[model samples]
Target chain A: MKQRLSTLMAAAVMTAAFAVQAQQPMKKAPPPAKAAAPAKAKDGITAEFEKFREVLEEDNPAELFEAKGEDIWKHKKGPDGASMAQCDLGLGAGVVKGAYVQMPRYFADVGQVMDAERRIVHCMVKYLGYKEEDIRKQPFSNDSKTPDHVSVITYVAAQSRNMKIAVPQKHPKEIETFRIGREIFDYRAGPYDFSCATCHGSDGMRIRTQDLPNLRKPAEAIRAYQGWPGYRMTGGFMLTQQWRMNDCFRQQRFPEPAYLSDSITALLTYMTATANGQVYKGPGIKR
Target chain B: MTAMKTTILCAATLACGAALAEEVRDYRAEAIAMMKRDFKTRGIATADRVHEDGLQAICNRTSDHPPKAIAERLERDQMESIKYPPDGKLMGDWKAGEKLAQSGRGMTWSDKAGVPGGGNCYNCHQIGPQETSFGTIGPSLYQFGKLRGNTPDVQKYAYGKIYNAKAFNLCSAMPRFGHAGALTESQIKDLVALLLDPQSPVNSK
Candidate 1:
């Protein structure tokens, strides 16, 4: 009788184990079921993009701008007879490599945090002695063949290609700046009452043919953060991060953001830090 | 009898008048003439911009949606115009791609010739989360690789999209970066990495 009881107890224990295993959620979901095969000619959106890729393989006009920017980088300018070579981009003075990947850092000399465009503008004014108005007033070139400051920024950004983004977040100021940036990111206002999160902050969203990235996610943050200072196809110009931000304000119908204002710098720090460890790729091309 | 004859004559006259009004006029020519007469060419915006290419003409005529067969044929023609890298390399540094995506400069009337242009991706896309300010013309690309997976096929798709958006959609609002010579091969490659590289922020943990 005792032996019989032991067998029954063992069976009950085995049943309990099976029930527990069944109740637990699987670590990963099964792969999606295959549906009716799509046409080979219509490989969804992927095939379409492949066609676009083939076209871009030819000569790019941005190369000319990059070449010109290189010249400007090494060229002597300003009343001080100094070149941007002496300018520091948070990686020490005269260092252009990988500087673009990490930006909006704190600088004691500047006494405040600054982004790439603001830093460049400061260098131009303080180091080069170019009038701020002159630099700001110089309109973008009309011709497709001209190079400008935007190109210079692009060239510089390209130098840091493939490097990891490491925007410092250890400083108190950096932390404060990031907090403010977060507020701005989530702040909802404007005619449409739109916030940055309205368009982003979610997954599987799209506008027309383009996909929207969820900025809250680290992977998306890095991919989006690193590709600034790019060449634009619509406006037919190269633009810096500052200009991009400024335009965003305009679209939102908000007052123009002060060029390189602490708000802007803080935003940059927040983005760069959020994107931590992602490879940098800038001086990119955009539609 | 005289009253009926007069009524028939009036009806014939009205038909002839309607036929005359129905004749199609060359509105394009007239518009061109008006533009040439009234519009002044400035520093960089030349009068030639008024002219449309064959594709543009078709798009204009069809209002962005043409017959499927015609669109396919035109797309094929457009594909013919694409230029691949000589070395067949299509990937560049994602770091560089990031900077390019952020910039919005170049090709303004005030700009000089021979300068580079900005991609202005943010004008249409929401790429990075840190950019509190961005546009909504294109879709956001925050976690492209996390959802899509970083495969060679995905990389190729991204490269192509950056190079020529139209190749994928006949009426895509996204500009044809490569088809129009706006972006270099290396630049496109870098952008590819920005979207597809596992180490890229798009795929980061």
Candidate 2:
């Protein structure tokens, strides 16, 4: 009886082994070569992105901000009662057309390089004689309406809408700003210890259903950088470029960035320079 | 003899397991204390933000996998904190919602008290088209209405998720916009319209 029991146990063990072998076949053939090389090949996630892009080709509501911004640009404002027509954006004075596309450039007068947003703030304060605190205090929108800052940025950016990003890098200060911005980009800290590169440096990375553009790549950088001062669907408010940078600092667990601060301008200069050839598409609509 | 050996082995194993569990508990406590000591409260960022609530404590202790019974109970508790709009309307103006999502202002140490805060949604999700400077922390919300349809159930889900993301997923990184008072009911409603309104750009082709 003992021998019979032992034989039965051996048979059971053999059956279990066979079941395991059947369940997990050894060395399954690789997927087709053509299938592997598809544009959405990171993990079959890109297939859905094609549909998203198709939807994005339609009209964006951020066009409204751009239109309003244009109006603000020509309208006389401030205690000086002057328009921003004479303000220089590194492309000569009062040249609205395509000026924004070449910003965050070296400015000899300011003795430093500045981004589009910082330059606008400078013009608003210095040339326009508008109080800096008043502009800063202005709500993103006036009770759900688009704000003046966003309108101005959109209008200015729209002037360079189809132009190539041409941020100047001739000055030594410009170079220094780029280097500092690069360091900040790679620096890691906070509860998650995440760096900007964690999401943006790698190609084909994503979070949930959104595709992360690799900021290191020129095309991606331009595609990513050109759209700012966008209208957001989730909050029902328009945002300025300064607000965008401030939020980025918040997510990084760093101290909140001062609006239109030098550090933020330097970072913007670096990013804009990196995207030197991409078409500008401002005051974008976003979900 | 065999019975006696088995009993001895069982006792030894139980003693070792108990010792290991106690060590782990002590280590966790030390880590929490260290974090509290190092964290500095500034402006809106208070020391209490670092302290875990009961639900968070459970998630931390179990590494996001509390016992099934405990998870269910915690979810129920969290649901109770959600406050619905008094007017019973789940959606408001999409145009207003667009502005709120775009603005990323207020609620920092530097910000003055009584100043309104921004939703900062573009930092994570793609809610609409035309936004060139959006981050990809959350999913693309473009065509949300067209894809999900503007049903009452869908509206409720969107509102609830925005209100307290943790209520749906215990460890969700999405901020509790409504529950935390980061957004008002009217703001949430506008956001809902931005996502679900057929005429909104989100639902447009």
Candidate 3:
């Protein structure tokens, strides 16, 4: 009778252990929908910066890209003849809105971390069977040209506009990725021996009249991260954060970071977490 | 009794998780290694360019605010590295200098080697009065010669500062145009003249 009791206890404990292991991969419950933060007195918003925000709100050029992106997201064309309607964007299949802020998070199936753009490209390749090389060639848009990748990112980011950033760091990989990103931010290299930290690590530092955001802190991180997928008034292009990272590397005199590579995704993960809880106010306009 | 035991077991598991969370994960070394794997050499931009020199490493390590004594020592070393022109003429044509200040084209990966690089002064300073668009990274040099008299010492100071800004302030964000070999001695002399020459728009009304 004692032996029977021991066997029954063992079976119950094993079931409990399995349950805990299974729960690890389950997504966190979606938080209550947050209202956009009231625009506090635009302290430090330069006259030009403020002017750009005020004037461009109604007729923001990013809308054009978003429209194009929506079309491409639904269109079927690649080898598999599959539309990206069911791309799993951390919030189950085909559900688009409010998912952007949580991305650059771990995707278990891919066995890697992926940002919004990287995930989009993965869906493109996996579902549509498009060549990675062909897709990456013109990831950005020009004055007269709109590329699928650039427009799609803008569209996805807009869906999450004003949502609170909530990139998860529950997984061990996610925790380690944040450390990896911190180091990358400070890593100094190149002919100029410049790092991203050189320009951005310090507060009150300006490149020109433009104020540099010190991304180490949460407040500044939110301000900087939320402003991308922006329409550049000067460049006349809808630029995403990935393009911004690429350009910064170029200016630092470092060689180009591979497209959608782990390094870039890690950097994104770090920024996304740093930007947590801030209402995204992008599809923004920039000088 | 079994329910109580299971509850205690769960509590113990939670404690183990808390302990594991306490483990520190430092990313500095891994990030450095990742860059080594990720960066590819293209054009004039080589892989070795990532290696920080002694001075750069110092500024980086200290967060651009080195100790006063160390900064002074390093500034002195930087000052010693400057090679004055053989003829002892520090001033060059303000016209050429003004042109050089206006252009910011140089040292980019796509830029051809052996080509003359710009002073890029306008990108960081207000030089010519006619050019309303200017970057404010460095202080305004409008009336530079007018504010500080254009004496021989002043001429030498401007020349030296343009050649190696780190020699003056050890961690100034201004690039070492001369030290980095991005600009020639003649180009730097022209920049000095642009700032110190009374005839230049920087000093003129």
Candidate No. with top DockQ: 3
Encode model 3's per-residue lDDT on A63-125: one tens digit a residue: 767777887787766666667776898898877898888887788897877888899888877
The 10-residue segment of model 1 chain B with minimum total lDDT is B31-40
Error of 2 at B141 (Å): 26
Better model by TM-score: candidate 1 vs candidate 2? 2
Q: Cα miss at A115, model 1 (Å)?
A: 1.0
By lDDT: ranked, best first? 3, 2, 1
* Candidate 3 Cα errors over 4 Å, as ranges: A1-56, A59-61, A75-86, A232-237, B1-26, B67-73, B126-132
How good is the docking of model 2, by CAPRI class? Answer: incorrect
lDDT of 2 at A72: 71
How would the docking of model 1 be graded? incorrect
Instruction: State the weakest 10-residue window (summed lDDT) of model 3 chain B.
Output: B17-26
Which is better, 2 or 3, measured by lDDT? Answer: 3
TM-score of chain A of 2: 0.75
Clashing residue pair totals per candidate (backbone < 3 A): 73, 21, 2
Ordered by TM-score, highest first, the candidates read: 3, 2, 1
